[model samples]
Target: MRLSVLDRSRVRAGSGHPEALRDTVAFARQAEQLGYHRFWVSEHHGVPGVAGSAPTVLAAAVAAATSRIRVGTGGVMLPNHQPLVVAEQFGVLESLFPGRIDMGLGRSVGFIEAVRKALGHDQEDAADFGRGLAELLGYFTGDRAVRGYPADGLRVPPFVLATGAGARVAAAHGVPLVIGSFRGEDAMIDAITAYRAGFRPSTWAEEPYVVISSTVAVADTAEDAWRLLVPEAWAMAHSRTRGDFPPLSAPDDVLAQPMTSRERGLFEQSLRGHVHGTPSEVAKALDHLVHRTAADEVLVTTSTYDRAAMLDSYRLLAGLYL
Candidate 1:
């Protein structure tokens, strides 16, 4: 099956305070026309580089602006939040958008040690990610017996964001599992096998659902797509391999920007795992993505320096689908 696009609502270059919100609304509207399935925002805090720190607030806006595309987190980092609060927030979203709302959960500070400590957590709080998962679900499923409350039986459905041990948690709880496609395909096979083998049906989820997110860039030409992808590609590679986000130059200006050999290595290896190329190339990658994850759905994590180029990329990919 063709892959489904999941917009990251990435902040545009030189974006103002409201730019991310405006881009999100516009992106959602345009994606509706392009035939994408769902548009998910990410979560980050104290990071000037990211704008999706409050995905729930933004998800409400996206839901109101678009009619068809499902809206939710690509993965909400649970370590920094309260489970009951998340449950209530998404619960209300579910009430408003109905079946169009998805609650993909995650287990990370999504920031860093300094930032996480500032946010009021110790290094050991990550151990409670499993507890946070249960609490968030209890709030959604009206499982008062478990520890959640937004007033009575009001509940929303939930999904798990599986990365490392999160895969096992998803399996144990029988929630939908979304492996971070930013990583690689090896863990995907391992996680999916684990989730299916260990799944236990829940009130919200029956069969095991696998929704892996991929950072995809499609354009009219391979070179053009690669050009549009440099900023995001550079940022992700720097974060994982080097512990920071590197400086990103303009698409037209990247030739002058210099990167170290190590930086290039990370950038290249990370790029190899993602879907980047023309529509035809992306289509082939997506086909392989489907078979590898055995995912019920594929969520395309799109990015660019600005919203126009990002929007163009998504539109082009949508055309490839039909």
Candidate 2:
């Protein structure tokens, strides 16, 4: 199975956004060296914890920093931008990087009502994602009335970052589907089965391709690996209860804090679905997950406060599969 990475450019408690973004670029170079298939970045608007707001721009930095390995967005939310503009931006990326670029698209609007208003979109705009996707694809194929200059004939591969009705949209459009594994195995498998059953052949993809996006952490011991997940879990729990996502704190520090019943519940819940263990243990879990889902690729999206530990976890994971 293909092993890839999706870095959210998450900021650490002591770090700034600039450092977070630079770390992403540097991480991409390291990922290429580790024999990873793809190194993709994410987009999060006005989120304090996430530094990767402009994915295409960040992708350019990553591409320039690495000679090999596919680079793309985990995704750019279609509801927040014009389809034509999205096409053109990707076109320029394809023009520069050629076969190395992947255009991963999502249907999400901004995180909150105010942010959505600032982006000139509402929740209802997500319903128009299917139409926007069609228009974006049309720009590359010359099927639309207005043609995008560099994009008209460029064959940049498109992948749908599946959420909610995303699998259906991907099936109709005949593109690869990138779906998370956090939602529960049965639900994810059902979505994949439905997507394949409804898939229609198109120039982008003749067959249904599924990439299971999951958080995986590997270390010398199972306990150490589990510790690596603590910071991010706390951040997620904090976001749910506090209305804002803060930077990752040290796992030890996070563990020391007293939590309310709600925070504790959410924090523990955040840690449950992820795969975290020693190298051998993690290998078995990942193998089983891939087998169960029949996934074409495994996109690792692990994050932590300890940069060294995070890198070590990735190295151990790469040793297992690469």
Candidate 3:
């Protein structure tokens, strides 16, 4: 029944970044008021629809606005940033918020071509993601470097978000791991098993903490939830068919488009992997996943069309959990 915020940061094409930041802060504040456990921003670059490219800054802003809810990244791509800089930023965050910050690192940038270019990188430029991951952990844990940084003091606790059976990294470091694979329970469990086997107890953790982050929405009625979820489903469909940087489709638009070829494939893939429905429905899915995976917590992602809908989604979803 645990719940946290997963902001898709649904900014439209003409939406201003300042406005998005303001809206995001407001959303975080509301999440805290509603008693959500955390507000985790995502790292996306060169995506017009998502403005959370700098999760550290956004996380700090959210932390400053709210007193209790945890604030951190659903992920910061280690391949895209310097380990030292990430260490200092999250260290500052930990200093400011103390025990209320969580750092989730990922191996992939949240977008494709434009995102790569924005980060001044290319497919060929990708760091050995595993190596970069180790380096980032080193900066925080006082292990990788022989000199100042990896040997210095930083109090940030970092987790790895493993989407495709890579949770072993989390185990090796003895930090928490978040896995949100659609329904690849077998794969997810396998990774968790690997992670637990590889874990080395650390200052931040003696045992494993695994959280499941999945798509979620809730409404007064099943039909209503379906209606609200269409925006998010369509938003994702919009991304795969048109590419991953466009704003969401209008409900009517998604309804109008006949599922075909690539779009159909994408929709089926997402449905097989994601959790989407009314509070009761989502709760059912949640319970099923928890029963199957024994996840310690759940992170709910709101990727709907508008800010209001997203807020309402969490309000209802969390209410169901309560």
Candidate 4:
């Protein structure tokens, strides 16, 4: 039952991107002191709400700031960059951090068509993820046609951030799988089952490893914990409805806004499928979730407008296990 964090470097309303990024680095230091297993960052291109556009660079900053906790990306989307460049970037990281770096890879392209074009990729490019993954792995193993400098013979653990089909890719590659819990329990279970069924032994992993990424908010009261989810939920709703993801707003501000039926529905939907409650309640839900999915680790990915409250939520969650 390992507990980890995946901070998106979320930009809060009234704050600049620099502050949000500095917050992430500072948050990693706190997370390390709190005894978390890993502290991972994320990548989002052209998303206003997310300041972590370059996860590898952010990961380096986090590693430099912390002593023990593992540092890596929640992931870097493979389709947007050349595998060789990605390998070199991580090669430099692993060389610097040694055993503390992880490579979490994802297949997602940019969020919108314009951003996708800017990245020189489109939706269809995501399908090439399998090929790209192989190339990236080959660099580390020195199995590719070209050598990847410091990357060759470097053994940085790789984890695939996947859904159903992506889970199959992870299984085929025989690396660890990092799946989200947002998509309903049944669907998540099915994906895990498929992943285990198709898993093959490779240098990366001898058996299937599953890390369930989830939104977990803990507080003194159930209502208070639920309130921590509001800002991100509203931002998600805004992205879906208005096609723009704004910085996180205070819970009170979000609650006071008038919304169309569609916006309201999406906002409500975003709030569901999370583990939020008092410490005891959240623990119970997480225990059940781990039991059902047989997850090797739990990656907490909770963001809110209030930084202090957010850190308190993580502190409470860490207290449950540490």
Among all candidates shown, the one with the greatest lDDT: 4
Could you tell which candidate, 1 or 3, scores higher by TM-score? 1
TM-score of 2: 0.99
Cα lDDT tens digits for candidate 3, 1-322: 6778778566653566666777888899998889898888888787767777788898998999999888899888877887777777887888788889888888775377765777876644343667666676676667754433422566666778884445766776678888875657787777777777787887778888888877776776766666666666666766877876566555576677788777776665554456666666778887898888788889888665656666787888778775
Between candidates 1 and 2, the TM-score winner? 2
> What local distance difference test score does each model get?
0.74, 0.93, 0.74, 0.95
Worst 10 residues of 2 by lDDT: 109-118
Task: For candidate 3, give the lDDT.
Answer: 0.74
Cα-based lDDT at residue 171, candidate 3 = 76
Model 4 Cα shift for residue 231 (angstroms): 0.3
Ranking by TM-score: 4, 2, 1, 3
Sort all candidates by lDDT, best to worst. Answer: 4, 2, 3, 1
Q: Provide the lDDT at 177 for model 1.
A: 84
Candidate 4: list runs displaced more than 4 Å: none
For candidate 4, the per-residue lDDT at 144 reads 94
